[model samples]
Target: MDADRVNTHTDARSETIRSATLELAQELGFAKLSIEAVAARAGVGKHTIYRRWPSKGALFLDAVLSSHETILEYPDTGDIVADLREQILAAVELLARPPLDGLFRSLLGEAQQDAAISAALNERFIAPQTQRTIDRLEKARDAGQLSPDLDLELAMSILSGPIYFQFLITAQPLTHDYIDRLLAALFAGLGPRP
Candidate 1:
């Protein structure tokens, strides 16, 4: 086969594998998901998946992250508060829903015991998302919306910490009102000093 056709074929197989991984994860939860099942679902050999991902955790991370790429992006709406609120709301909606919530919870639970999975989760998902939020916060700071000296990393943590707490710890409902109050307190603290 020609190079272009080969590349297309490879890409198609990768996408099929990712889709299969996600479907199986949603249906069986991450604990029960296995390479054999993914291979059967995708119609690809187990070796093919092994070649692409080092482990089931790596494969699951790729599948979930790729499927929800947009949720990780921070919007630039000029109004930093609005942008942050929009992105946070999107994430809350995702985590508060079925399939993904259970899938993600299972993945996180796995990560807690597996060093490689934990590192991959941080590197692939958490770090990138944190950087995106920091970048947006820096832009807002440059625009005078946030204090120039504000610690962008800390700000990013502040925004996400509570949401994760409620979603993953307290098991509280992630309501729009909750997000609004969170943003209100965040901006209230971040706003210009009197």
Candidate 2:
């Protein structure tokens, strides 16, 4: 077979495996997912998954992060508050969905006990998303919507932490009113203290 054809075939297979991982993880939850199960679902050998990812956590991280990346567009509408509000609302809506909600709970529970899983979750999912948010904050800073000295990473945490807390810890409903209140509080504190 030609090299380009071979590459395309490989890419297709990788995507299939990732899709299978996402489905299995969503259905079975992260704690219950296994390489054998994923391999069976993907119609690939166990060795194939092992060759791509050394552990179940890594595979789950890849699948979940890739799925999230496809859906989460970086909102840059020039108005920083509107951009952040829209982005946070999208995240709340997405993460609060059925399978994803359970999947996140399972992954986070497992990650706490497994150092490798924790690292993979942070590196693959959390860090990338945070970095993207920071990039947006940087753009806002450049536009004079935010302070140039603002800690962009911390700002991301300030924006997302409450949502995660409500979802995972408080078990509170993330209603539109709650989102508005959250943003209001954040903007009150995070905006320039004139």
* TM-scores, all models, native as reference: 0.88, 0.83
lDDT (0 to 1) per candidate: 0.81, 0.76
lDDT of 1 by residue, 35-133 (tens): 999999999899988877878988887788777777758778799888988998888677567768888877888888888778877777788788898
How many clashing residue pairs appear in each of the predictions shown?
0, 0
Runs in model 2 deviating more than 4 A are 1-10, 147-149, 190-194
Best by lDDT: 1
lDDT, candidate 1, residue 41?
Answer: 97
For each of the candidates, the C-alpha root-mean-square deviation to the true structure, in angstroms, is 5.0, 5.2
Model 2 Cα lDDT, one tens digit per residue, 126-173 = 777888888988988999988678877697678888888888899888
Q: What value does the lDDT take at residue 26 in candidate 1?
A: 84
Span of ten consecutive residues with least summed lDDT in model 2: 1-10
Model 1 segments more than 4 A misplaced: 1-10, 190-194
